[model samples]
Target: MEKRLTHFSSGSGCGCKIHPAKLEEILKDVRSDVQSFPNLLVGNEASDDASVLKINDEWALVQTVDFFTPIVDDPYVFGQIAAANALSDVYAMGGKPLMANALLCWPVEELPAEQASKVLEGAKSVCDKASIPLAGGHSINIKEIAFGLSVTGTVHPQKILKNTGAVVGDVLFLTKPLGTGILSTALKRGKLNENGYEALLRVATELNTIGAELVAINGVHAVTDVTGFGLYGHLIEMCKASEVSAEVYFDKVPKIAEAVQYIQEFILPDNTFRNWNSYAQFIDCPLPETFAWLNDPQTNGGLLFAVAEHAVDTLLNTFQKHGTTQFLLEPIGRILPKDEKIIYVKR
Candidate 1:
């Protein structure tokens, strides 16, 4: 007799995305069209976080739209997670969010409209925190529940962060940990515990505002958010685009404590396999058993940054000095000159 949000979800958060390799298949032709428009600074060609269109000599417009089915049972919390996930793109590209419109889909007859209002309120609360306005959105009647934001922001034309530009000797770091996908899957299967839920909510709701701070950091090179394709998948995108390879330390990469337990217990999201299959050929995994942790898709995840070796301290100091959100910063790996393998994962 109670209403549940995840009950209507087909996939949780970014886990709902098309599998990485499959997505490449779908976008292959679309990627070739990127060169047709010279003003399109960052497009699908590089697998960057958001599309950056140059506006003038000084500025470029960063625009992205993201939506996902519920990742939490509470409508309000689900709304927060979805909005944070969508806004992450702008930050990943080193832009500050300016405004947004809502995206909602629900079964009107099955769920009360009041619940949808709660979802909008949750998204609005996050937008307000980011100092952006939620102007409007489009809604539709659908069988499954979903919500997100169409965010627009601005960045200096010269400073747009792309997946390209990660040079060799660049130290790598993930602003957050992995395992949102696994935990959200556990939640959907009714197997997740309170600790797991707390972990998921904390990571999903925290905005990746640290991205905006990176614009001032000279060391920050290529940056991308770890999302549906998992950390390795997104990192591979960065490597291929930047024409560099990586050395990811398996133990150094952070993970949610609860989610780690869930994985050890053999709880995994379907996307884990989807992600691995998408790019498994390109990686050299010395520890094959740890692949699940490495490829677990994330929801509203952290920004993965490639910082110059000399600027590593400057980058970490920025996180400490940002003084707004707390980051569980960890140096997971480093960029290497392109080798036959795109990534080499070791303990």
Candidate 2:
């Protein structure tokens, strides 16, 4: 019998992440004296992508770890998505991944070891594409089947990008369409088509390498990859860190075609509500259904970049030159001066 990987898990992909509010409360009491080490360029002080430690005057090391339950039925595709999602953190910080360590949790009594081997092979394939080594990792028997990577990468100290520099008047660009969470939910319900599955796999597995390239563009102010928290949550974090507000055009936001259908059908992950409950107080969206995409938890999602107004044309041109489709480089909104509202959604 063919075992469905998602069947054994409660949450799908990055949707398994704890609610942002709970996470903040959990980490609030934890003492992180990052200021004690001047070399810590970026730390837990801000909800940035990765922790960066300066190795020298020129280079800094970017470190991050992410793991989650399977979102796809195929173990190989799940592995690819998990690894790509983990590697996204380094890329989000404008860094090149150098190595990764696998993190796996298996249900020995429920599934066979062969399935786990396929998952490892899937991760190795992605690591090979990124030119990184899967150095090592640890595993354990758990109730759910989970897998991901702890990725390490390097970037120039001067060029390291963080989500803390978004400025008023900067334009926001989303590198990929929204709706992975919705589509994954549909998949779990056996409502997703083969085309939808292919779309999800393609988008999730594709590395957000554009972030690293944006480092050469001086106007690129802030870079953050949209993942578990969804667009609104991550944007809120950026606004708070940079002390800026955002004006997003709901109509302009790109979304996968299949996701739109699933959303219309009211198929959504459990985290959808949890995500909204965590940050709804800070966001001003007229329609409640807008949260379907705004707060929908994305797994290996796209990078949400803030670029200077004057450089928006250049950014688009660079993406075009790099063969990125116009659909993928959609301009969804702009940053605004800090105000009473952290996010303002224009319908």
lDDT of 2 at 176: 85
TM-score winner among the candidates?
2
lDDT tens digits, residue span 13-58, model 1: 8888987667778987767355678898887778788999998999
lDDT of 1 at 179: 82
Model 2 residue 60 lDDT score: 92
lDDT at 286, model 1: 77
Candidate 1's displacement at residue 182, Å, is 1.6
Task: Give candidate 1's whole-model lDDT.
Answer: 0.88
Backbone clash pairs for candidate 1 read: none
lDDT scores for all predictions?
Answer: 0.88, 0.90
Instruction: Assess every candidate by TM-score.
Output: 0.96, 0.97
Task: Please give the distance, in angstroms, between residue 126's alpha carbon in candidate 1 and its true position after superposition.
Answer: 0.4
Clashes of each: 0, 0
Clashes of 2: 0
